[model samples]
Target: MTRTVSDVIAALDAAYPRELAEPWDAVGLVCGDPAEPVERVLVCVDPVTATVDEAVETGAGLIVAHHPLLLRGVHGVGTDTTKGSLVHRMIRSGIALFCAHTNADSADPGVSDALASALGLKVLAPLAPHQVGGTTGIGRIGELAAAEPFGDFVRRVAAALPSTVPGVYGAGDPHRPIRTVAVSGGSGDSYLDAACAAGVDAYVTADLRHHPAGEQLEAGGPALVGVTHWASEWPWCGQAAEVVRAAGNVEVHVSTRCTDPWSLRA
Candidate 1:
């Protein structure tokens, strides 16, 4: 039984439907012939140069990414540009690229859901529940089972995610008790209001802005636990790989390379 790129794409869309993605997001097959036979697939948080190398080295016919390589409109994909170079490399290697950004986030067992499960939280519902579907939305609100100190919860988050250079950081008093929690993998400062409205004890997310975070805390919202964008969303790679594996007899590989732009911290 041979699975083509289109077959794998259909499977991915079923898990994270294209309709669920943000209007501005560029989700779906970026480049590849639908009829191209796919024998192996590589999953990663980012579709950067390093991960592309990993796919080529691993002989992966398809690359499933959480973030799109080219999100905004581009005039050209010449080899001169960074994204263009990636497109060239993948095309030369006969590799297909597909992204599942906001759509995956809006799915029931999406990125945030994976993060919530890793922290051992019993999910209550989506943090910003979509009115249309009711079941699917971005982010999630859940309970920690037993209330733990803010400091302990931070430790648990660090342990659950992939270790990064900056690691995890927390705001608010370490002694604060945390029972109900909200999580939004990747850049989630925008969901502060949603997390606050849910009345969670803490919010675990990535890319917290200085002003927004400070203002939220000043207003006495949920305690903020910040993590690397890569670490926050890394858990979804395994889940996505499993989805692909279940869809077909293709080999699925999760890239171990740390594609996080931040390589060092002082």
Candidate 2:
């Protein structure tokens, strides 16, 4: 039986419930007809031209992105703007777009879970459990498969995530013993307090701005390892693809293309 776009979205919705999403998030289908039969899918962290190009080249019928393409309000999707151009291109190429965003962040086996798996963390619980979803929330608190020096843990993370410019950065003593950790994909500075509260040895996440990080470390918070936002979230693409694949008869491909905005580091 041929599954329509609706089936794919339904599968995604089941795996990453919209109800779990933050109130401000833009989730669900962004474009393409629900009735359109889907033969192939491409899962990615960002919905940029590069990923879209991959979808077009591979003849993928749908692209499931972790980040919302039209996250902010846009009065028009006219071909004049770069974002608009991508929208027009996808439409003309018969490709559909779907965004999971924050909802995927809070799912039981969600974005953070995938990141934890990639980093070999034995997930114990959520860093910030949502009031509604039992044991499902913003980030994951876990322990390493084996305790290693803080420096070794940093090296492990560098090897685990997809390499990109501005490689992983660490805060706190490199000699500090690290066993337990809390991980959240993408920008996770917001969870610094939760990570501290969880009393984990370390916190692994992306996009850790300086001021907050300095303050956290100054105030005797957990060790921090910050990687590229894209690298941090890339693992979820594979997890998401697997969910969709298990749901129906669809050839799902996790895009290896680096959509991380940082091309070079000075």
Candidate 3:
């Protein structure tokens, strides 16, 4: 069976509902001929230079990513800049680009949910529960049936995530048992205050900044563990692929390239 770009977009919209995206997010089709037939789709956390090349090499007709290739309006698509070059390449190759961004973040079985599940944590409620009916929000708070030591949870997260950079910063009592957990997929230091308010024993996500991690720990907030931002959210590709596959018969491939743009060798 054949499917149009709009058909695939419709299926994604039915599940994620583009309207659910935060006002500032750039979600939906960034580039593509919607009427073109889609035989293969690449699902990724970020649509960076390498991921785009991967999609083209794989003969993918569409690229579905978590981060928007064009988050803000682009003044030009000239190859002089990185993003412009990518836009030019996708346009020339006839590969569509679609992003699910904040919409995916806020979805019930969204990025954080997938991350939490990876560590066997059960979502008790949202740490920053999204307001229903298109309202914006933050991360989620969950519970582990049997509390695991913070060190144990860290190992579980590191094992579950794809090949990623080990975090340079860490805080809090590593040996303490962690029961209640908070999860936010992307750069989540901004939400430390909220996580603390929720009273979660540990907060796990990626890209923890120095000030927030230091201050939060010193101030006696949730014990924080950092994962690669890309690794943390990559699980959603499978989850989203499952959603898309359930909606239609199509090939959904998860891109293997990290697209993280970082490698911590030490």
Q: For this target, which candidate reaches the highest lDDT against the unseen true structure?
A: 1
Query: Which candidate would rank higher by lDDT, 2 or 3?
Result: 2
Candidates 1 and 3 compared: the better one by TM-score is 1
Tens digit of lDDT per residue, candidate 3, span 109-217?
A: 6888888888788877766766543323557778988998888877777777887665423467878889999989888877888898888899987878888788888
Q: What is the C-alpha lDDT of each candidate?
A: 0.93, 0.93, 0.83
Q: For candidate 2, lDDT tens digit of each residue in 1-266?
A: 88889999999999999999888889988889999999999999999999999999999999999999988888999999999999999999999999999999999999999999999999899989987447899899999877899999999999999999889988889999999999999899899989998899999998888998999899999999999999999999999999999877899999999988899777
For residues 1-266, could you state the per-residue lDDT of candidate 1 as single tens digits?
A: 99999999999999999899999999999998889999999999999999999999999999999999999999999999999999999999999999999999999889999999999999988988888448799899899889999999999999998889999999999999999999999999899888988889999999999998999899999999999999999999999999999987899999999988888888
| Candidate 3 lDDT (Cα, 0 to 1) | 0.83
Give candidate 1 regions above 4 Å deviation.
Answer: none
Ranking by lDDT: 1, 2, 3
Error of 3 at 129 (Å): 1.8
Candidate 3, which ten residues in sequence have the lowest lDDT sum? 129-138
Per-prediction RMSD in angstroms? 1.1, 1.2, 2.1
Off by over 4 Å in 3: 132-136, 167-169
lDDT of candidate 1 at residue 200, scale 0 to 100: 93
Query: Residue 201's C-alpha lDDT in candidate 3?
Result: 93
